[model samples]
Target: MLPSVVLMSALAVGALGANTTYTYTFPAGFNIGLVKSDELSSWCQGQRNECPSICKGSTKQNTCEPSTLKFNCVCADGSVPDVSPYIQTVPFYVCEATYGQCIDAHPNDAEGQRACKAAATCGSKNASAEDTTMSSTTTAASTTLAMATSTSASQTTSSVAAASATTNAAALFGLEGYSTGLMAGAMFFAARLFL
Candidate 1:
């Protein structure tokens, strides 16, 4: 019984260890499929220390002590680089590497604020700035996730609404057309929210 218990504990630890420090593969067409926030996160955790990257103003990796799936994106290349489906980067965030060491930014920085910001040991930026390149990269990645989620939700809602047009459309018609006016309004509102 004692041996069994020890074996169980060790097994559990191994699984946990794998998760704590693991790698995620961005396969050839990973960007094509649905956003793999989970996989990306794992990779980021191991790579630059950011994962499940975000799409705010800039991408950021969580640099907090005890990090979750956090990471910063390094510009794979210049030009209209595709972070992933629908997620295009006008400008890419190069890894937060100026000389050699990572930017030891303070908590005040917008990009520096994210505890999970990774891939950057820290940069020369003295933590007074607003955002970092990693911030942009992570933001772009996160935006991709958000857009994917939004698109999925929209598709689902549209599909359901299409069937319920007779009733919902009638009810909403009293206020505003659910499919046209209402949805359009909602979409605009969502755009603002994201923007």
Candidate 2:
């Protein structure tokens, strides 16, 4: 009877542990899909205190689960792996500013630069005084995303009304057309709110 009770307790604990959900909060404006896996690995290597090999291994290993789109640490036999060690959550503004900064610093990294610009587009330009580069990058990427979306006239107007008062024409439309430009602007505004 004692052995059976102990076995049941251990089984229950294991079952609960397997399904535990860990929520990792990413920056408000940053899109996980925009950045590639390799870029994340590279970022970890450069920014983390751990050895680059271990950082790279962490990324390569299935530590990052596809379901959550965030890394989870799973240790192999006799190995202790620190899962989710590389995530650095910053304010939306800082993340945008950093992306803009990275564009200049790492010119050769096209994917990283594009991902950074995409993130910046979803954030606000309120940090412009602190980092002009971020402002510029956000403007360019927002325009690109808007153009890719190519919002319709009615959609533009309704979206503009929904957008925050702080949103500006330049921030939304890339200054293309005073009337239709509002569409892109509103779309960007929406992205900031939701993404």
Candidate 3:
């Protein structure tokens, strides 16, 4: 019975530490209504192909269900991809791809062309705005750190230690999702023994 319990606990931890799925949605102002239902799957596939180019990882298991508006990418190795670059450019890429698709589907439809063009422009502007916002946030964080450094030595030291500890704890907990699973397993085993 003890061996079986231990095996279950280990299995639970393995399951918890498995692949993570990431969802990518069309940026705001993207007119999903403009895209035909049949075309969504193709668009998503294209986006999936674009993932490795944009993000810093492989995306072999990325998929998009037909008629769905989102793409799903699985992190097979339990390492979360750095999606900052992908996030910054996805809007523009999505818009451009939609526009290209629209053109391919209806070359002579002036109204469709205009709509697609407008959406593409909106996406471009959105990407630019996102870049600016991220820059501002980074600047603000740097300024805050500089300010903290100017505080009294003891207070600064304490604050830095607390911040470092919190960051380390969070990182450990987040890594491979193992810490959470281990804690839960330990609790389960303890409860079983008590019972």
Q: How many collisions per candidate? A: 41, 4, 0
Q: Rank the candidates by TM-score, best first.
A: 3, 2, 1
How far in Å is the alpha carbon of 108 misplaced in model 1? 50
Q: Model 1 over residues 1-195: C-alpha lDDT tens digits?
A: 111000011112332352122122222111212324554344333333221222222322222111232222322221111232211110112222211112243435656445325532322321212236666778999999999999999999998889798787678776754468778889999999998
The alpha-carbon deviation from the true structure for residue 29 of candidate 3, after best TM-score superposition, in angstroms, is 2.4
RMSD of 2: 29.7
After superposition, which runs of candidate 2 have C-alpha atoms over 4 Å from their true positions? 1-18, 41-62, 65-69, 74-195
lDDT of 2 by residue, 1-195 (tens): 111100011112342453334343454444445566666554443333232233333422223332223443322222323323323312232354456566765689888777766755333322223344655689989998877677665577777776754367456565556657778789999999997
Q: What's model 2's TM-score? A: 0.23
Error of 2 at 154 (Å): 92
Better of 1 and 2 by TM-score: 2
lDDT of each candidate versus the true structure: 0.36, 0.44, 0.54
Q: Global CA lDDT of candidate 1, please?
A: 0.36
Task: Report the poorest 10 consecutive residues by lDDT, candidate 3.
Answer: 1-10
Where model 3 places Cα greater than 4 Å from the true spot, the runs are 1-25, 52-60, 82-93, 97-195
lDDT score for residue 31 of model 3: 55
